[model samples]
Target: MRSGNPVLSDSTFLDLGSGAVLSRPADAMTLNGTIAKTGFLLFLTVLTAAFAWNQSISPAGPTAAAPIYMWGGVIGGLIVAFITIFKKQWSPVTAPLYALLEGFFLGAISAVFAHLYEGIVMQAVMLTFGTLFAMLFAYRSGMIKVTQKFRAGVVAATGGIMLIYLATIGLGFFGINIPYIHESGLIGIGFSLFVVVIAAMNLVLDFDLIETGVSHGAPKYMEWFGGFALLVTLIWLYVEFLRLLAKLQSRD
Candidate 1:
């Protein structure tokens, strides 16, 4: 099984796919269970996100989101993600924690964006969910096949995007700007669109991975892992949508 999501990559589910049958069928992963857990994680994320967002607002006007939320969320979320990734068995606990941490960071950053560009957060949320359901439908309907070639293409494209982002961040240390790619110009818009498309494609791969795990009778705890993986992709997708919408709105 392969997925563009780093959390659900090739090795993530290899043992299950390699004919390692579970001794207890009742302890195996289930579609319904995965769905339920995903919903719960999403709820926890939104709950904390709303809390953080509310904390950022005031009667005086929008204020800077506290640095604590940004730094704490980013660092805490990353650490929890790494632990969950390396210890898949810990997902049942770490996954929810990951969502909670991410919510604070997402909320803080989103508040900052919403302050600069009114209505952008709502637009981004709508677009994110719209793309999510659309992609899920396309996958379920077999409109998009997860062939080997498709997986390879998405994996390569995702890697390239990561490299470009890393390079951009590294260059920023020396005060070097990536120029048009980060501006409200055509190139920036196009780049964001490409990233959004790739993010959507990764969803298809994530769905495929979830199905594979179910078919292979992966352990029940994998339900949490599967949900965690989906959340990661959704988070990435949402952030990209925010960037894309912000760029589009900046021109107006």
Candidate 2:
């Protein structure tokens, strides 16, 4: 029931209620409802991403204002995401907003990567969705069970990666850079590959959490929260894939 995703955990459903049934469960959460909400949030993300993408590739090329969109999206998305995490009930309103804000960031970043490597953004997008669907199929087919050990391992690995990233950032302020982790050498490639695998494993955990939420008859609004969590993982996976690809391409 545990998940590497910070937004999802065994306590997620329990925190809503102890019973499998709710008193007014007429519109309780369902797997289908969560799926629909996920699609809608993705649509919102794509819609805004397209706008930012076009802006980045305009005839004038990346403008001085590009950083505005990038930082605005990053800071705004973080704030809204924290709000949704703490106030699950606000997910219905905050989730779509988060997606839209994230789109601004993703589009600008993707554009920058695309400029560096011609077709990298498309490759990353394809691989990201491919990994997502492949993991979903495996989860649905019982090929990958979310056993206690599996959850714990993924959670531990994810925490370790987060700490490494935090250390890198902290050290950055002192003008020191982590050597292999961000470089395009063999060690960096290996590190990126490991992170990609960990990010992919997280999808399986997210799938289990959504299924558990539905089976527990969680409140209808939880569908939005579940979808938001899924979107968060997807975004993370995509970004990791992009980084991995960039590293590989840099070697050329």
Candidate 3:
């Protein structure tokens, strides 16, 4: 199986040898288990996100301080995510922690966007979940098949996007900006639209990977891993939506 998610790659469900094999078939991964785990992680994310969101909106809260939570969430979540990726057995513990940390980051950043763009955050949230369910239905109904060509195309597009983002950030240090891609102009809006579409397509790849993992009878802990991977993609999609909406609003 293939996925554009860095965590849900082809080798993610590979058996590590005899030690990786589950003695009981019942202990193997299941689609239901992954759904349950994903729901739990989402709950954790929302719980912490509410806390940060509340802080951001507080009367005495300074927007400047929000970055503490934002950077903390971003850096800490990355660390935990890397640990979970390298040590799949630790996913059950790390996945929830990753969600919580990521919530801190997402909430702070989202609050900043909300402050600037009024109800843009809500619009982005609605669109994100809307796209998610729509994609899920499409995948389940076989409206979108996980063909090799499809997977390859999505992966290639994702890689290209990542490279462009890295280059943009790299140029930032030299006091240079990537025109059009970061502005509120037509080109910038078009770029964000393209990114949003690519990010949404990644969900299809993620779903395919989880279904494949369950079919392969991966370890139960893989459900946590799968859930974490999905969360990563969801977060990416939401953030991109926020950026796209913000750019569109800026044009007004």
The true-versus-predicted C-alpha distance at residue 169 of model 2, in Å, is 1.6
Off by over 4 Å in 3: 18-23, 58-62
Report the lDDT tens digits of candidate 2 across residue range 110-207: 87778787799999999999999999999999999989999999999999999999899899999999998899999999999999999999999999
lDDT scores of the candidates, listed in order: 0.87, 0.88, 0.89
Cα-lDDT of candidate 3: 0.89
**Model 3 backbone overlap count:** 0
What is candidate 1's lDDT per residue for 1-252, written digit by digit as tens?
Answer: 578888986656544444464546798888999999999999999988887888776655555664667677889998999999999888999999999999988887788778778899999999988998999999999999999999999999999999999999899999998889888899999999999999999999999989888887788999999999999989999889889889998999
Give the Cα-based TM-score of candidate 1 against the true structure.
Answer: 0.94
Sort all candidates by lDDT, best to worst.
3, 2, 1
Candidate 2 — what's its lDDT? Answer: 0.88
Give the CA lDDT, 0 to 100, for residue 109 in model 3.
89
RMSD over all Cα atoms, model 3: 1.7
